[model samples]
Target: MRRRQFLAGGTTLLATAVAGCGHPSVVLDMDEATAADIANQVSISPEPGSAEYTVVSAAIENASSTRRGRSELFDRTDTVRIGDSFYEVSETPLESSEVTVYEVRLDFDPADSTAEIGEIAYEELPAADRQRLDPIISDDNPPSGDGYDVGIGYGTTQEVGDGSVFVPEQQYDIIVHNGDRYRVGVSTRTTTETEYRYEATAVTSGVDSFADRVRDQYLFTLTGLSEAEREVVEEAIDGGYFQDDEAFRSVTNRIREHEGLDVTDSYGTWLLEYEQVEYLTYVEW
Candidate 1:
């Protein structure tokens, strides 16, 4: 979580944008008090201006090293400026065999707000690739025949917080598997238990809805599973639900929308354990 190098400091907007490489970045106007507090916190620094900024439909968590591994900081809704035209300053999340983390939407103060760039217009890409990115930003939810019914499950099995280096934060992952189609990785957040029952109805509902789309529609999928794994997967699929499509789509789209190169020139490691990986679908209220 503490891995990213907060922009060392800001410069001219042009230089800053170029340095950002088109990824969304925070331009800090934080005074000493705020900067120091944010030193341990992850956040976005904005350029300015956001009179018509829209509140998030969902709660936006700050993407942390554990959540996104610091590499995907760019593609978030860092700052959406709505002055003359709608403009969003977002970074493209890095794609890899590992999880591609979507940067969390940082909260904006009145002074910190910016016009949120709307969805990446899918029409902007080639016809074929456009097909791939299309579903990611569609205003259409599942009930329009593109979405159906599915199954869901969540329960916190543990929590780890100790002086030990092995300790982890809350431990949980939400899995949404469509009936005989592509399954979506809904979440992998800090949890003590292998499973957690989130009290929120969105989670319970989102899980079931996420399952249906995979079964009913032709969403993007990663193939090449072993025969044994494939056999196990066959049983996990389900139909969809109408009410939770938007939230279900969100969990699925972030990963579905990601595909690119991800590598590290340097490296470091501590004690690492491959725990049994579990997946669940959740909608943060």
Candidate 2:
């Protein structure tokens, strides 16, 4: 039997070997404000190259005909140049429905800032490696099954099955709490048949250290929402999230905006446009 594997744009590693032992061709320049701005915007917990989990958003590409989902490309391997250093990149697709999210993972060894990798094309990799990377660009549609679809923002939904969720790759979301901005990511899934439990915990530094948080995993269940909450979601879907919702009707709306969707169409149309990532790193049990 073929060994089942996660496909592209998921947690799959793109580059493996260090290629040549020679020096790096491109010397990274992380001094620019753009570098810091990008780093800060994505939320890098602790310092980079500390051998700990560091999340970064390298680039954000609006949805396109070829790239159906809003692709967030990350540098998991020591490929992309970041702030005068090269760190491994990890892409984790947090949730998929109307929007698909991929969390970038970076690991830096303080001394390896000058790390070097070959600029080999995707086709140059070994046959096995090439096959592994095939799913990066796949034609899989999002699933519509019997389960509670929890809204996580950006028109994304978490399909809960087997009463558990596992996010191996660190995917962060920007949210507002108590009139303050915060970055959040889930590491575990906790739920029950009726009530959903969420424990707010603050443990990350950077951005706003004082921001409230429910670290690791933010437990929320579909049935847990009060009648009013469910009504709001239903209303948004009925009226078109982008049409009647004041928060999303404006051009400044970041999370709900999508270039692929027609300006005159409704957000609910995403259901037909919704396609699954070529691969799934997390399985819904």
Candidate 3:
């Protein structure tokens, strides 16, 4: 339950409490650009105040539904932040067969020219051992049976009578084990057909917005290529995701370049969230 919770009072009240409460601390959207900007301006000095913030990425998708999922960390908190800012920081296993996906965003302030959005796309990867994921041993894997790491995640398969299940259509069936062996599974559909989600319906959005934009550009880039180039593009998309490797790194890299910056870890941030691991704010400076 150590997750983000936004102050209830309207923006006016919350902003005052955070920015004017006799402290130099600022109230920034849960985004990296905002964090970087604040850090540059005033040296983000943490003083036991909360770095956990919310951004309401999508405005009231459904008032009734929002009320329902509001309490839990998963179930779509809508507004989520990474690391201290929207730019999430994380350490990952070299290769994991199991995968989890967390989509988080980083945003910028309109007035701050240096501020820019950061998009994170993580795939809670499984351990590299193919045998651990072997259909024969899936039941033995720690994540198969019981609890999954993420606060909110669902399963497509189930077990009955302590027996391995059979799947005819699939060359292999995923085994269900119990205990701490679970990981967040992204969309079941192939990474090939991607569905695009924007913050607003002609509405509003940001860093996560940039992530979405870049993803769009990549798909468009892949589509725009000629038949010969399309095959390479398809291969690139098939391998992991444009976000997971150099294929799409430049999409966000240019944002940094235009700002006259050298290199960036923005894409790395996205990879972390994909795991669906829970994190609490911890900043040294």
Instruction: Report each candidate's C-alpha RMSD, comma-separated, in the order given.
Output: 28.7, 27.5, 25.6
So what's the TM-score on candidate 2?
Answer: 0.15
Candidate 2, number of clashes? 18
Candidate 2 error regions (>4 Å): 1-34, 43-45, 48-83, 91-248, 252-255, 259-285
lDDT, model 3, position 23: 30
Per-prediction TM-score to the true structure, in the order listed: 0.14, 0.15, 0.16
lDDT of each prediction vs. the true structure?
A: 0.24, 0.25, 0.24
Which runs in model 1 stand beyond 4 Å of their true positions? 1-76, 79-86, 90-221, 239-285
Worst 10-residue lDDT window for candidate 3 reads 276-285
What is the lDDT for 128 in model 2? 36
Each candidate's number of clashing pairs is: 50, 18, 25
Q: What's the distance in Å from true for residue 23, model 1?
A: 32
- What shift in Å separates residue 129 of candidate 3 from its native position after superposition? 37
Q: Report the lDDT tens digits of candidate 1 across residue range 25-114.
A: 221111121222221121233334321122211112222112222233334324222222222233333333332221111111122122
